[model samples]
Target chain A: MIKGSLTLDPKIIRQDFPIFQQAVAKPLVYLDSAATSQRPSKVIDAEMEYYQKYNSNVHRGVYRISVEATEAYERAREKVARFINARSPKEIIFVRSTTEAINLISQTWGRTNIQTGDNVLLTEMEHHSNIVPWMMLCKEKGASLRYLEVDDDGFLSLDQLDSSLDNRSKLLAFTHASNVLGTINPAKEMIRRAHDKGALVVLDSAQTTPHMTTDVRDLDCDFMAFSGHKMLGPTGIGILYAREEILDRMEPFLYGGDMIKEVHKDSARWNDLPWKFEAGTPNIAGAIGLGAAIDYINGLGIDQIRAHERAITSRALDMVQSIPGITVYGPKDPDKRAGLISFNIKGVHAHDTASILDTHNVCIRAGHHCAQPLMEKLGVPATTRASFYVYNNNEDIDMLIHGIEAVKGVFKL
Target chain B: MSEDLYKEIILDYYKNPRNYGTLENPDMKAMDTNPLCGDELEMQIKLGESDKIADIRFNGKGCAISMASASILTEMVQGKKIEDARQFNKEELLGAMGTPNLGPVRIKCALLPLKVLKLAIYSHLGKVLEGDDRNL
Candidate 1:
C-alpha cells in the first residue's frame, strides 16, 4: 500500500538543513512541518543556481540563455510529472498553490460538466480550500453540494459513502490526508468506489505528497492538487495533476502570452495540454527549487521518511498519552495517520498551551488549523498540533514533552 | 508575555477568575467573540447611585491572557463611577497586570474582555464603543 519501509537517521538529515543551525533558544524543535517545512540547503542552492546561471524567460526567446531557461523550467514540470507517476509532463500544470489548482478545475471542468441536478460530494473533514470553491461552483450552477459524515473516531464511513454516491454524484473531492485529524483516508478504495458510481474523484493531496508517495495511476483520481512549500520546496509553486484525457478537454484557466498558440485581434488558438491552464510568466525559480526538492527526497528515500515518522509518532503517542488529562484526536493507530498529532490538555486552552511551549523554545501550532467544522465536531476551540518530518527525532520529542510540562506547571494542573 | 509575568499574574486570574459569573437581568450587558481564535467574552454590569458601577461580572472560555485580563478588569472597575470605568484604557489595564508583552495575536486576546465591557457600558448609555480595538 505504501513505499520506503526502511528506517533512517534524522540527525544526518538535520545537517543538510541550515535553519536548524541558528537557534533562537537552546534547541529550536520545529513541530510545525504541516504548516510549512524548513528548506534544505540543496533546495535553496537550486533556486540560486537558476537565477545565477540561466535567468531568462521560457519558450519565447530564441537565444542560447533562453533555451537553457526554458529547459530548466519545463524540466522541472517533467520532474513533477514523473515524481507523481503521471503518464506525460503535459498532464502536470503549474499553479500558485493548491487553492488555485482547485479553483482552476472548478472554473473550467465543473462549470461545463456539472448541471442543474448534479450533486458534488465532499467529506466533513475537508479544508476550507476544498469546500468553498465547490460551494461557489455548485451555487452558480444550481447544483447541490453534499457531504459524507466523519465518525467519532475520525474515519469517514465507506458504507455511508456507498449509499450516498449515485448517477447524480458528478464529482467527489476530499483530502488525501487530514491536516488536523491526522487521518490518512484510504484514497485508492475511495476512488474505486466513486468510479463505480460514475462519479469523478478530485484528490486533495496537499497533506500527503510530503509524507507518502502519490501514484496517480494506482489511485485513478481524475484531478489532484498539492503544494511545493509543504513538501520542503519554495513557495509560489504548486502542481495541478489531472488525467491526460480530462486535462485535454478543459479550457485554459488563465489566458496570457505563454498559453496561446496563434492570436489575432478577434480570436486566439490555445496552446498545449499543461500550458493551456498555466498563464503568464511561470515561477521559474520556484519550479527549479521544487525539482531540487524532489531530487533531495529521492536521495533520502520517501519510504524511509515515512517509516521514521511512524517510529517517532508511535513513541510520541505513548509519551503524550502517559500524561494525565491528555486527549488525542484521530485514529489511535499510528499507521492510520500521517506525521502529525492534534491534541489538547484538559482545562487548558490550546493558545495558552502553545505560548507556554514557545517559552520553552518548542514551536507548535495552536489554532483551528482552518478546519472549523472539524473543531466543532471535536468540541474544541482549537488544537495544539505537533507535526514531525524527516529532520525531527526523539530529542525534539523530548522538547515537546518539556514544553507540555511547562504548560502543566503554569496551569498548576 | 514575560514568562515570569505569565506564571504569576495571568495564570492566577485565569485559574481563579474573579467576578467571573453572570448577573440575572443585568443593567448593562454585551457579548463578543474573536473569530480569529474563538475567544469568547460576556460582561454584565449593574449600576447604582449616580450611575456608579455597583456590580460587575464576566463569563467566558478563552486563553490565559483574555481570561486574566477580564478578571483584572472586573476587580478594577467594580466600585468606580461608570464614567471613570468607561474611560479605562488598555495601557491602564496592562499596567495593572504588570505589563507583560502580549505579542501581536495574544494582544488581541488581552483586549477581548476590554472591548466587550466597553460595549456593554457604551450600549447602556446610548453611545457606541469608541477607539481602535487593537490600539485599546
Candidate 2:
C-alpha cells in the first residue's frame, strides 16, 4: 500500500491548482478529469500572460508582440510534436478539441479515401466523438460501420479486431484508453493488425495522452487526437497528429485567412503543413496555455504520474467495490485500466447516486457519459463514474464512499 | 437542492409508483426521453364514458426523481377530465411532490412526466403543445 501511494503527494499537487482553494464546498474533490481537468496556476498564468503582455494575432503581425505571439504558438506546436514523438512539427495540427480534430480528419482524409461499400472499423467502447463522425461520413459516402465487441469485463479482443478487418475496412478508429471503462487498450498491437490489413488507424488519445506517456510513432497510428483541457490546460485547443506523408497529401479541412499562402478572386494555393489546416485566427492563448501545461506535466514526470494514478485507481477500485451490491465496471486489475472507474449500485439509479453524492459536495458524473452505444453494450442505461487525477487522493475516495452510504440510506438499499 | 430532494414522499412514490404499467388499447399515449439525462417516460390515458381520464399509467427507467414524478403524475390524472389533464402544469405536479427545491437539471427530471402527459393529451386533441418556454 505504501508503494501504491502517490510519490507526488496529491495534497501538494492540489495547491498548484487555484480551483482547489475556492469551491462551493471546501476542499473540492474533483474526480471527473476524464470529462475535463482543472488547470494548474502555471497554465492559467501562461494564458493570462499571452492575453496581457503579447495580445496579437499570430503569423500576420510584423510588429513585436505579433512575432512573439507567432513564436509562442509555433513553439507550442513543436512541444506537442516532441511530446507525442511525431516525425515533425508539420504533422501536428492545432484545432478546437479532440472532437473537432476527429471531424477534421473525417472531412479531409475520410471524405477522400472512404468509398461506397467501404466500412470503417470502430470498437464498442468509443466515445461519441469518435463514433458520430464516422457514422456521418459513412452515411454520406454510402459506406458502412462495424464495431469490435467488448467482453463482459470491458476488454476488446485483438482476435476479433484481426477478424473484423477485411478488404472493405478502410479505417479503424478507436480510443487508446476508454473514458467509461478505463480500459487501456493494447494500442500498438491493434495498430499493427490494422496496418497488416492495409487499413488506416485513427487513435483517439483524449483519455490516454492526459494520463500517461503516449508516443504516436511507437503506436504507428495514422492519426491521433487529444484535447488540452483534459490535461491541465485550458479548453478550446487540441492537437491532431497525422503521418506527415498522409497529411502532406490530404487537402486542408478548413480554408480561410491563415490556411492559404496566396489567394485570388477564384484561385489560391494552400499554406504549408500544420498551418494549412488552421483556418482564420487560432486560439493563441489556449495553445500557449497548452505549452505551459506540457511544461507542468514534464516537471512532474509522466511515468511518475502514471504510477501514481495506477496506485490510486487500484485503491479507489477496491474501496468502491467494497460496498454491498456495488458492481464496478472496467478491468479489475488496475494495470489493465487507466485512472478512472465506472460502476453502479444494484438498485440505485446512477443519477440518484450522483445526486446524493452531490449533497455531500462530492462530484461525480452520471448518465450515459456520451457513450450510449457503450452503455447499451454494458446493458445499463447509465453508470456512476468517479474518475481521478493528480490532485485526487484517498480522502476523496473516502468521501465517495461516504456518499455511497448516503445513497443506500436515502434509498433504503 | 440535494437535501430538499429525495424526501420520504418522493422515495415512496419512486419505490411503489402508482399506476406503473401499460394500458391496453389506450385512447392517448405519448413517449419521450430527456435527452439531457436519457430519462425516458411513456404516458397513456384511457377515456371514460364521461370524456375524462378513466385510467392513466406511466413506466420507464430513470432516477428516483423522474420515476417518482411519473408516479405522482399518473395519480394526478387518473380520473381527471381531458381538458384538466392537458392543463396540468409543472407547478401543480411539483406541488404534489411537496415542492422540493430542485435545481434546473433535476427539475427537468421532475417535470418530464408532466411534459409527456401534456403531449399525450395535446396529440389526442390534435393541438400542438406550446407557449411555455420552460417546456412544461
Q: Runs in model 1 with CA error above 4 Å? A: A1-6, A23-25, B23-30, B45-56, B79-86, B119-131, B134-136
lDDT of 2 by residue, A85-170 (tens): 99899999999999999999999899999999999999999999999999999999999999999999999999999899999899
Candidate 2: stretches off by over 4 Å? A1-4, A23-25
- The lowest-lDDT stretch of 10 consecutive residues in candidate 2 chain A is A1-10
What lDDT does the true structure give each of the candidates? Answer: 0.89, 0.90
Lowest lDDT sum, 10 consecutive residues, model 2 chain B, at B127-136
Error of 2 at A387 (Å): 0.6
Q: Please tell me which predicted candidate would have the highest lDDT against the true structure.
A: 2
Q: Taking the candidates in order, what DockQ does each have? A: 0.56, 0.71
Lowest lDDT block of 10, candidate 1 chain A: A1-10
Candidate 1 lDDT tens digits, A1-413: 12233287777888999998885557788999998999999999999988898788988999998899899888999999888999999999999899999999999999989999899999989998999999999999999999888898889999999999988999999999999989999999999999999999999999999888999999999999999999999998999999989988888888888899999999999998878887899998999899999999899887877888888888888899899999999988999999899999998889888888887778899988888888888888889999999999888888898888878887789
Error of 2 at A62 (Å): 0.5
Interface RMSD for each of the candidates: 1.5, 1.2
